[model samples]
Target: MHQQSAGQLPAEVLAAFQDEQQQLDAAGIPAGVATVGSVMPDGDLLDAHGEPTTLTAARNGRPAVVVFYRGAWCPYCNIALRAYQEQLQPALATRGVALVAISPQTPDGSLTMQQTKELTFTVLSDAGNQIARRLGILTAPTEPVRQAQAALGLDLTTVNADHTPALPMPAVALVDTAGVLRWIDVHPNYATRTEPAAVLAALTTLD
Candidate 1:
């Protein structure tokens, strides 16, 4: 079942996200997310409130530290998201950076995620995996992984309601004020994520 707010996050789902959180080891800047995207893609995702928002509009006049997650259904993605909520935003803002999160879930699911994680930044909804594929980070889950997720009680049936069943590979990108890509970070495994400390350092380097 799909939820419209985070408060409705089933205990099992919350626990799953948290467990995925524990698997992270503060990945360094050069490890996984080092592959730079050739060009930044233009796309829009609805905010948690179900309002349409363009990526360009969200990055207005400031650099943006963007993180793309699968959806509320994924445990590992949420763990990475929680890390951003707790550490990345403040550090990035001090440097005139905006924090934006993208997901292929609907607006209702996005809201559920925000409430579930107490996220402080923008959570944009990309109902179709359109934007995700554009950045070259989206991928379909393996059959085994899908089966495991289903057995674990995750309901992906509705998360990817738009068509393609795709998710971002726990990726992060630092975009400059001019909306150009300064750096890109992505992990092949869903269980790992970018370290906030490393991201802070990378943001400074972009200066």
Candidate 2:
């Protein structure tokens, strides 16, 4: 993705992203973040139609793979989600595991992503980063990156439901039928993602 973007995006924009990646790598995952065996927190979320929902409702008594992304405006996020829709959803469905994608973006953004990606899995709006905060996966673009985003005509304050630049670090959590988190992977850098194959392998370790 970086290789392709290098040919298309401005040099300053690329530099800003690279700088953020370096900073994130240096900081690493924050302390006290939720870990395996933790009970996943339930929180209010919005469906594609702006209707109220929750993680529990989305799971519907089935084990679930919960994905937290930055927003629909992120190309990296769109790529990962589209891949999950194509590669992960079908395999997970066979195992009776629900696949859900959540972001701090508005319901409108969620709807657009779902339709544009033709994603059959549940896409939700995590207003105010409720679940992400509890899971300790939340982060925000740096000032330099935010400026770069504005240059590209993207204003996260308006794109996100929380009206802030805050976003959840791209992360995935595997929760069991009883709502207990079995495995999790958090990426401090927004450019990277957890592969479906890794998640499938993690599932094998569960009961």
Most accurate candidate by lDDT: 2
Cα error, candidate 1, residue 185 (Å): 0.6
Off by over 4 Å in 1: 1-38, 111-117
lDDT by residue for model 2 over 1-207, one digit each (tens)?
988989989999989989999999999988968988889987989988899999999999999999999887888888898889888999999999999999999888765535555889898999999999999988889999999999999999999898999899999999999999999999998889999899888888566
* Cα-lDDT of candidate 1: 0.69
Q: Which residues of candidate 2, in runs, are more than 4 Å off?
A: 111-117
What is the alpha-carbon lDDT for the whole of candidate 2?
A: 0.89
Task: Indicate which candidate wins on TM-score.
Answer: 2
TM-scores for candidates 1 onward, in order: 0.77, 0.96
> Residue-wise lDDT of candidate 1 within 113-167, one digit each (tens)?
3555687788788777666676667666655445556666655655664755676
